[model samples]
Target: MEKQSRHIFSKVFTNAVLIIFSLSCIFPLIWMFYSSLKEKRVFNADVVGLPSNPTLKNYKRILENPDYHIFDSMFNSLRTTFLSVLLIILCGFIVGYIIARVQFKLNRVIYFVFLLGMLIPIHSLLVPIYIVFKNAGLTDKWYTLIIPYVAFGLPIAIFLVEGFVKGIPVALEEAAAIDGSSFSRTLFSIILPVTKPILTTIAIIQTFACWNEFSFALVLLSETRLQTVPLAMKQFSGQFSSDYPKIMAAMLLTMSPIIIMYFVFSKQIIKGMVAGAVKG
Candidate 1:
């Protein structure tokens, strides 16, 4: 009876802690969403209070304003994120597979090099990256962003993929080889499908990084038309007077897609993260 009581107490304590943590993470988003619905005056008057007068004018104004370019920035972010993540997955998978399956003296060395990249702070590379891009006449280009995003994302992607790949049974590849399948054919057909969970994990992480990245975008992109969501949000702040409600509304809009995506793929995300962390 004492043991049973202890177990129940432990479980209840754990649940209470989890609920508190969840609320802490969620409350800010809830506040932002609520503030977005409030009038500018109401938001400033009562930052945390329930709005007596809710309004959608903030959303309507942001969407209708030509200078805001929220839609264009959204498209650019989507394009950059999707293409960069796609490349990272493809390249990381190929490299990870080779390291895991191919028996070569240099394979471990190459894998170690990728792991070393993770140790290098991205901020440290910004100056050199800017100078090189400037010299190459690549500044303000979408490809510039794509290249660096893929480069930064590769190290972790390779780590996750390689870890997951190591746990895959070799017999599957042997069976494929026996059936007259080429190495590439075996990889796509047998290996990739099995690695889907880790791949999804990589995609989710890289997507979030690329989507939220502001430093690289700020330095690399100069043109107003090329600005991404983060940069656009920075510009949303008026010089003379800040509209807190409008800013909050824009932020909510900027993060909505990712939030929806997270909710939709929450299960896959949890599975992938756990599996990758464990295997890697």
Candidate 2:
């Protein structure tokens, strides 16, 4: 009876702590959402309290304002994030598979090179990449952000995928080979399907990373049409100084898709990260 009582107490304590922590994390977003519905004066006057008179004027203004380009920035972020994740998963899987399965002279060396990319701070290369892009006329293009997103994203993807592939049974591949399956056929048909969990994990992670990236987008993209979420949101602040309500509206609008995606995929994400569960 005492042991049962102790377990109940512990579980309750743990739940209380978790609830508090979750509230702390989500409170800001809740505040932002409700605060967005207020007028500028009401928000500034009572930042903590709910608005006595909720209004949709801010939302209407952002949607109707041609200068804001909120929708365009959103589309750009989605397009770039999708393409970058696709390329990262594809390239990372291929390179990671080779490093895991093949024997070669420079195998370790090449794998370590990607590991080095993870070690190095990507933001440190901002100026150099900008310079190179400028010289090569690659800056401010639709594809410009995709390059860095894929490059930086590859290291982690490759690391996770290589480790995951290493755990896959070697007998499976050998059997495929013995059955006279071509390399491409075996790769795509057998190995690729089994790698879905880890790949899904990589896609989710890199989607958030690429979408939220601000520095590279700020440096590489100058044109308004080419601007991404962070960039357009920056313009939102600049264009509406001290108007906290309107700025929050812009942020809430831009943040909705990612928030929805996270809530939807939260379980799959947790499942994918478990060790050796990729094949399970």
The residue-level lDDT of candidate 1 at 138 comes to 94
List ranges where model 1 is wrong by over 4 Å.
Answer: 239-241
Ten residues in a row with the worst lDDT in model 1? 271-280
- Summarize candidate 2's per-residue lDDT along 1-280 as a digit string, tens digits: 9999999999999999999999999999999999999998888789899989999999999999999999999999999999999999999999999999999999999999999999999889999999999999999999999999999999999998899899899999999999999999988999998887899888888988999999999999999999999898886555436678998999999999998887898887776667335353
Q: Which pairs of residues have clashing backbones in candidate 1?
A: none
The lDDT per prediction is 0.91, 0.91
Best by lDDT: 2
> lDDT of model 1 at residue 187?
94
Q: Over 4 Å off in model 2, which ranges? A: 275-280
Score candidate 2 by TM-score against the native: 0.94
Question: RMSD to the native, candidate 2?
Answer: 2.0
User: Model 1 residue 162 lDDT?
Assistant: 86
Q: How many residue pairs clash in each candidate?
A: 0, 0
Give one digit per residue, the lDDT tens place, for model 1 in 49-83.
Answer: 98887889999999999999998899899899989
